[model samples]
Target: MALLEIENLAVEFQTSTGPFRAVDGVSLKVDAGEVLAIVGESGSGKSVSMLAAMGLLPWTAKVTADKMVFDGRNLLGMSASERRKIIGKDMSMIFQEPIASLNPCFTVGFQIEEVLRIHLGLDKAARRKRAIELFEAVGIPNPAERLGHYPHQMSGGQCQRVMIAIAIACNPKLLIADEPTTALDVTIQKQILDLLMRLQTEHRMGLIMITHNMGVVAETADRVIVQYKGRKMEEADVLSLFESPKSDYTRALLAALPENATGDRLPTIGEIFKGAAQ
Candidate 1:
């Protein structure tokens, strides 16, 4: 069985207009020690789909799935308390915005230690030690000193690393990174990506990377799922998807990438067709 299996997952929001389908009948799987990327433009339901899978969607949202399984357990049938128990230990998510996710008043060590204390049931001293080890493992320099500093004191890359440390503190089987590199510079982005890859190799963790940046997907993902307007347009291995895109939407996204897009222009994904275009 797959490590993570999402079958016919659907999500809706009851808005002023009516019930809007943000995610419509999406299904995917992630095996152990593999990186799967969900790539699309903004509002494509890439993030919402995974958020539903993780049971992180807002209370106002309505989510339904035929089967959402992890490690042979059905997520859809589980209680909120049961799901919460599995979240940090068996599955963890590193969100897009580090600053927004972190507490402004607490030090980085305190934040990570909280995870250790709650998940691992460690004492204060043990939690601090584990937090330091986590920081070091994520490549934070002078982890002991850095531990005492708040999130605002660190650079974007460092804050991201801290988030990573916290996420993996309990050695989760699955890690969901939602646009993790969005706030970092090019150099820092590379470092963060490399760190994630290295940690995945060491821990043999399944990864779900959600991003609008195809370049990042190309570098990190083993398989790619292309979404447009809450629908999946294409799914293939990384090489095959890049070499020969089948869908018009996929081809148009590749075409929209600029020649010198590294530091300058971000690629713009093409609009989804209402139907087959002439």
Candidate 2:
């Protein structure tokens, strides 16, 4: 059975201009120990689809998902209290902006420990010890000292590592990372990906990496799900998707990427969206 299954998922937001379907009908599966990449532009519904699955969408948003299952249990049918227990234990999410997602007031260690305490029922001492271990495992140097520091005290890369630590704290069966490396420099991004890949292998967890970076997808994904304008464009194995892209939108995205990325002509992503860029 798949570790995570999302079938016929759709999400709409009731805004001032009537309802907008942020996520059109979409279906996807992530098997055990698999890395699935959801690639698309900012408004392509890649994030919204998964957010709906996790029951994290705003109250104003309406979501309908058929058989949104995690480990064989339907997520959509569960109560909010029941879902809360599963979120940080059986499932976890790493947000797009680690800096913004992480709390400024709490120490990094406390934040991680909070998840452990709530989900795993660990005592203060045990949670503290486990939180420190998680920090070290994610390659944060001087984890002991770093643990006491607040989010604002760390570099972007360090902050991301802390976020990773929190996500992996309970060794969840599935990990959904939404644009995880979006704000980091290339080197730091690579390191973070490496760490995530390593943990996925070690834990045999299903990983969902949602990002616009095809380069990252090429490096990590086993399967690929391409989204465009709140709809699924195509789904294929990583190599097949890269080698013979069936959709024009996927091909256009590939074409827009820098061949050499020379001079000032870094490619603009706006071209792939079809609508006029401001």
Writing each residue's lDDT as its tens digit, candidate 2 over 57-170 gives 888899987778899998888999999989978899999888899989898888999999888899999988898899889999998899899999999999989988999999
Model 1 CA deviation exceeding 4 Å by range: 260-268, 271-276
TM-scores for all candidates: the values are 0.94, 0.94
| Candidates in order: C-alpha RMSD to true structure | 2.7, 2.9
User: Each candidate's lDDT (Cα)?
Assistant: 0.90, 0.89
**What TM-score does prediction 2 earn?**
0.94
Write model 1 residue lDDT over 210-270, tens digit each, in one string. 9989899999999999998888889999999999989988876776677535555555543
Candidate 2 segments whose C-alpha is farther than 4 A from its true place = 260-278
